[model samples]
Structures are given as structure tokens and as C-alpha cells.
Target: MASPLRFRRSSERWNDDRIIEELYSHLDSNLGARSVTPHYVGPDGFETRRFEMDNGDMALFTWNDDFAYWLGNTETPPALWRTSKYTFDEVPYQIARWGQRELLADLTVESPWLAKYDYLSWFFLPVLFSKDGRETSRAFFRKYDAGFPDTTRDEALSFYERFLRTGALDDYRYTMASKLGTSQYFDKNRMSSAMSEFTVAKLLTEAGYDVIPEIEVTTGHSLDFRADPRNGSHDQSSLVEVTRPQPPTQRAADTPVAALRETAETKSNGQLNEHGGGAVMFVDCSGFRDDEWSAVVGEQPDVRHRPAVVFRARPSGAIDAYKKGSVPLSLSQAVEWV
Candidate 1:
């Protein structure tokens, strides 16, 4: 767990001159020579301007939309508003690195709006690193996400430094996923599910499988991950469904085993055709144990899915497999298991 993020709402009155200076200070570093022009869009709208950078990148900067309102009264600081855009496409690594620097510096004095966005960049920019086709990078993070920071900009900067120096970007995606899930910014369930799916995909990839996350095999049916053995044919592949099981305190109507079985059986009978050999199920068993899961599966001697494999994934990254009549194989080995 990391420190909680804090946002300050200032009620102090500000004039156009100071606001313009703060805007220029944050924007001029990336944008070169430019004239400042501010226009009133309306209440709840933004004051906007355009500038061109020395690097030939064009940008539009928006000062606080709420700043004009807070000028007369100091009751509550208006929500800080700032946005920027580049004419040319910018790379993810560059943006991530820039975000790291921005987060380290104190922006509360000049412009908290950019600071807020910079903090969010910590959550979003790393996504590009994974998107840039860095499977290993994504895998390392997904596996060791607990080592990274989920909140607090300073801690994130520390994590980024090591991530950059090593060029591994370990735990970056997972950290972002964790924040998105807990943050008030996004839908909790969607973020949590995406994080779980991403973790499963990365785990499978690290296990020597080339995985596709959230792949839709049929209408209204998407497996957490679908992967083929690294050097094998599609027939050797498996469709994996992942779940983050809940504790008894948080448990609802169903158990982890029941959920795992349902998902596996859904594609048990030619659902995947010959594209996948079988189904691999992973339950985040940090809330449960191997013996507990075994008890549930043990009752069903002849399971619906004959070749189904269930994995109990502990929070510490340990795994236990329960596939009747099959050898005790690691996840990678099971990928090619017959």
C-alpha cells in the first residue's frame, strides 16, 4: 500500500496577470516563443490560448475556467483547470519521463491545475509503455506490482526513476491499474476487472505464452486472456479466465470455485473450437487457500470440463494447480501440457 493522494482546493483570489504568469511558467518549457492571449469562453468553460514550441510542437493551453469566479470571493477555490495539446504526436516514454519531472517539483505555488494533471499522467502515461509492445515490461510490472506506489506523487517519481534507469518499467502498469481501481476518477468494477485481466495476461506472457487480453471469442463472451504456447500451434493454446476472489467478509452469493467452474464450462464444449485446446482458470486465492479450493473441486470427480485446469493464485505470486489426473506442472509447463 502507498500513501493516499491529496488535492488542495484554494479559495485565494487570483488576478489575470498572476494566472497568466503561472500558465506561461508551466507551458513555456515545452512551448518555445509564443504570445499570450486569453479569451473568456463562459462560466464552466475555459480561458484558452495557443502557442508554438521551439521543437515545432504546437500547443493549446487552457487556464482555470473557475479562476475568474474565485477572483471576487475567497470562499472555496474553484476547481483548477488546465489542458495542453501538441501539434505533432509525442512518444509515451518521453511523456512519462516528462511527467516524472513535473510531479517531483512543487506546483502548488504556481499552478495546481497542471500538478493535478501531472499526477494523473503518472497513472495514464505508463499505459503507453505497455501499449508500445513491451510485453516483458508489462509482465515484470504485473508480477511485482506490490513493490510500486499507487498514490502520492513523490513516491511515484521515485518508482519512475528506478523504472527508467533499469529500463524495465516494472510494476508500472499494475500500479496504475491499482490507482484507477481505488481512485474516485473511474468506475471501480471496470477498473478492478481490467487490472485483474491485465495481470493475468502478463502472467501468462511471462509464463512463455503470447497472450491477448480481453479477447472476444463470440458475441457477449470475452475471456480474460487467450494465449498460445510460445513456439507451438494454435491447437496447443488455452483460453484463460481470471478472477479476484473475495474474502468471507466480502463474499457475496457465490464462491470462487463456482465462479471459476461457470467460466470454464462456458467454453468447454467446442466454444473455442480448435483454436484452444482447453481452458485455464486462475482465482486470486489470496483470500482462500489450495486446500479450500481442492475441497470444492474434489467433490466433482467427473468435472464438466474434462481438461479444465484451475489455478489458485496467491497474493505473493505463488500458484497451485488443480487439474485431476494431470501432473503437477508450472503455469508455463501447463501451457503445452497434453
Candidate 2:
């Protein structure tokens, strides 16, 4: 699959006239490309050119004598686009810096709706502006409150913006942000499920673990996180898999407790069962309202799996949580341990 944003490093010497001609020819033919003034000026010593097509596809070529870089969402060019892809942070500072400015300009240059959620726009820039997801992702934030029910769009944006500003998930920006997806239509379930991972990351960080996401294990699947405890003597990694129960109104389980149990049981039967053992299950009830959460927390229903955390978080930075089985990590920082 073509990457949402492509960043490539080329060592074939673009400073030479012959190479430059070949590059332009390939882009012009494949992408119906025409050069325009780059919206953002790159660092000194870098020559930058921006291209646009009738379809709105864009490609940026920037290079200095020592390094040549390509950042674009256009169709794959001949040999250059086939080169390895680099994440936004993997490229050299100058190129990455320019890419941020250039890409952000490309993303927000015309979309006035995005202006208010500056932090969210920047945090999810890769996916929010991706070729396939640009419309749907933005719509989710703009119209759907990013799937947070009973909340205004601005409130939802503020909740996420505040958390993202903490920079806790900066290391996994691409993987995590892309999880919000680029599908043609907005899916509340899928988008909210993706955001659940971010909530789990926040919980894990507050609980004092060095949180690493998308951890690979013996099972073919990738677990959501591997958090190392920072306690004075112990050094064991804990794998956490997160699942979010649909709000009671959205699911057949009309009661909050039933919804939480049914949702967690499905996960226990599927991915967690496949994971075999030694992983913690986190059932997030953040989508629930005061009464729904009151019911679930009041009952403290068992999620069918031990070593599980059942929690609800408010946008106000409040968390009510209960654990089943012997949960190994300390979570007193943010969770009230309800």
C-alpha cells in the first residue's frame, strides 16, 4: 500500500542537471505535475520546489549539496519513490523541519475549519492530511467530536489538544495517528477505538511506566503496549491490550454493566485469547456518561479476564477505575482506584 505521506532520501546526486531533468520528467508524466512556488521556504542551502496537479496531489522536492529529500502525497515516481520511506522524525532536521512547514501549509492552507484545533491539527497532521483520510478524519473532529458523545466539538478538541500537548505519544506519532484511519467515511466505532489507545497510553504514563506501543510478541499479533515498571527493584515488562465498550446507547447491551462485560468478553475471546497469557486487559469506559459510569463503577463488574483494568475517564482529567486479578502496574497517580 502507498504510504499516506512519503519521505525518501536519495543519494543519486540531484545537483547534477541530467538527474534533475530526469526527475522532473518522471513527475510530470506520472502525476501531471507543474511547479509552483513552495509555500514554505526550506533551510539555507536547500533548493525547494513544490508541484501540484489538477487532482490536488502534491509533491515537494528539496535538496542541498549533501542531501536530497522528497516529501509528497503524489503517486509513486519511478525509482525515487520506491526508495525506503522515513517517518517525519527520521529525516535530517532541516528536511524534516521543512517538511513540517510545507506539509502543514498544504494541509491548512485552505481548510478554515482546521484553524481552531491547532494542536490536534499538528499532532495528527500525517493522518489528518493524508490522501485517503484528509476529508473523513477532519470531518470526525469537525463534526463528530472525534466520537466523544455528549461533548461539543470544541470540548472534544480541547480534551485531545491538552493531552497531545503533553507530548507523551510523540515517539509513536505516525503509528498512533494513522490508527485514526484514512477510510473514505467516518466510522465512530473505529475512530473511537483508535482514540482508546491514546487514553490507555495516557493512563500507563500516569501510572509511571515507560510506555512503548505496538509491541510484538510470540503471537502473530502486535499488542497495544509494553510498559516497563520504574519501581526501585523490579524490572519486568507488562503488555497491555485495550478495548473500549460502546456507550450503552449504541450497543444492544442497554445497561452500562452489560455493555462493559459483553465488550470485554468479546476481546477476551478473540485477541486476548490469541495472546495466550501475561498481558493485561484494559477495558475503557470513557465513552460512557455520568449515570452509565456510575452504574458500571458501582457494580464493579468482572470483565471475565483477570489482570484487567476497567476504567472511565472524563475530559476533566478525572479517572475512576477498578482492577480484576493481580494487576502488576501501579496506577495511583491518575486513577482513583475505585
lDDT of 2 by residue, 4-74 (tens): 56488887667647444766667777767787888878778888877787677777888777767877766
Let me know the TM-score candidate 2 reaches against the reference structure. Answer: 0.88
lDDT of 2 at 76: 56
How many collisions between residues are there in candidate 1? Answer: 3
lDDT, candidate 1, 1-338, per-residue tens? 22122212233444557655654444454444464342223223434443434533232333253422211100111224432222111323333233334322323323343234443334433231221222222232343332222233344333333223332223343433333332223232333434455445545655667765555764456666657666663336666765554433334426546655554445454444333544555544333445556655565433344444545443333445556444222465333222
Q: Return the clash pairs for model 1, or none.
A: 10-77, 32-53, 141-171
Clashing pairs in 2: none
> Which window of ten consecutive residues has the lowest lDDT sum in model 1?
69-78
Off by over 4 Å in 2: 15-33, 79-81, 112-119, 231-236
- State every prediction's TM-score relative to the real structure: 0.43, 0.88
